[model samples]
Target: MSAPNSLKDVYLDEMKDLWSANDQMTRAVKQLGEKVSDPKLKQMLEHSVGGIEKHTGVLKQLIEAAGGQAEPEHCKGMEGLVTEALKHGIKEASSDGKLQDVAIIAQYQRMSHYGLAGFGSAAAYAKVLGMSDAETKLKQAVSEIYKGDEYASKLAEAVEQAAA
Candidate 1:
């Protein structure tokens, strides 16, 4: 596709990026769940996969509504985040479950923050373009991501105490 020339175009690009990010996160969280030994953290990660799938579907619908193809543009930012997460949260912390849980929480927050920013931006663009329905959906996705991030933060506190 070409460079975004209008607010609608920008919104479509944001949706595509989010779609890719959610796809990557779904896989990353599943793999991280397998590596984590903390029952609570494992369960949270498992639940996150479902949320990511739902958000991805929402993004696809938004893209189609905007007259854009419902396909993902590669999200290099998410790719980098996932790679680093696997290395630090899984491979490097293999011997320590508590530490792995901590790493996973940190990595999860980083990715969630990215999603928050992307969805927030998309919602703003949607508002500017008078696309109220798209804006509402994007805001809903942001709320869900924020809740997950808050949960991860609580888990991080528990993991920290355990590690100490």
Candidate 2:
């Protein structure tokens, strides 16, 4: 078997990937805020945009603490995924308030799931790297995003189901 990378290298690489994804989402959320007609969805997007910016700052601090560069390598994967989501939302556009809200919630939750997974992994890496404060902060971030996704889904489901 090929030799595995050193633990520090592995952790740093994961942070880089997460940083790239965050960079992509940071811009994507703003564009997304404009795409959805629902006021609530727009607010959620705005809130998430702020949270992502905060997460990016924490990531930068963590990377620098690890002796790695704080700069991000752009994540084309998240960019394409978000772009496609926007396109799909547009193509399937509707005036029905409930349907539009459902679409926005689904897309937002999907993105949140991505963030939760990435952040959770990063937290584990930070813990392994002996970064106690970074681990705690990342853990909190992952939990908060997961809760937001659940709350949004519940609100959207209530609207969709009521309309149905």
Candidate 3:
């Protein structure tokens, strides 16, 4: 894609990046879920997978609404995060199930926070462009991402307590 020359173009670029990020996150979360031993943590990751799918659809709609093709650009940031997550959450914590759960929760939050920032920014851009529908959708996505993040935080507390 060419350099974004307008606000709408920038919004499109952001949507593409977010689409890629969400796709990568969904895959990583599923892999993490498979490795997690705790039932509650596993369930949380499973639920998040659905939300991530819905959010990706929303991003596609928003991209079309903005008059852009819904093709995802490679999200290198998410790629790096996922790499680290797999290395530490799965690879490094193989010997300790509890520690693996803790690592997954931490990595999940890091990814969720990234999603929050992207959705928040996209919503703001939509609002600035006077695209109320896009803004509302993006805001809803942000809320969903936040719920996952909050769940991870609670899970982290539980994991820490278990470790103590």
Candidate 4:
């Protein structure tokens, strides 16, 4: 994508970037799901895949509404985050089930925090653009991401206790 010449351009770019980010995260979460042993964690990851797909659809719609192509721009930031997540959560994971679950939670939260920032920024841009519908959808995605992050934290605590 070209350099943003206006706030509208920036908004469109952000949506495109998030579209890519959600796609990457969806794949990573699925891969991680296969590696996890905990039933709750597995379920959370499965749900996340669906949520990410839903957010991606909203992003595509927002991009089109902003008069931009619905194609996703490659999100290098998310690429790096996904790389790190896989490396730490799966590649170097502990053999112990509880410890591995903790590592997975840490990686998952890192990616989720990244999503929160991106979605929140896009929502702000949408608000400034007077695109109330886009803003609402983005805000909803952010809220869902927050809920997942919170659940991951709780799961991490439980896994840690089990490890102890």
Could you give candidate 1's per-residue lDDT for residues 45-152 as a string of tens digits? Answer: 999999999999999888888899989999999999999988888888758789878888898888889899999999999999999999999899999989988888
* Alpha-carbon lDDT of model 3: 0.90
Note the Cα lDDT for every prediction shown: 0.90, 0.75, 0.90, 0.91
Please give, for residues 1-164, the per-residue lDDT of candidate 4 as tens digits.
88999999988888888889899999999999988889999999899899889999989888887889989999999999999999988999999988888888888888888889999999999999899998999999999999989998999999889988
Question: Across residues 114-140, which tens digit of lDDT does each residue of candidate 3 receive?
Answer: 899999999999999999999999999
CA deviation > 4 Å runs, candidate 3: none
Candidate 4 segments whose C-alpha is farther than 4 A from its true place: none
Q: Measure candidate 4: CA RMSD.
A: 0.8
Q: How are the candidates ranked when ordered by lDDT, highest leading?
A: 4, 3, 1, 2
Instruction: List the pairs of residues colliding in candidate 2.
Output: none
lDDT of 3 at 72: 99
> RMSD to native for every prediction?
0.9, 2.8, 0.9, 0.8
Output the worst ten-in-a-row residue range by lDDT, candidate 2.
1-10
Cα deviation at 28, candidate 3, in Å, is 0.5
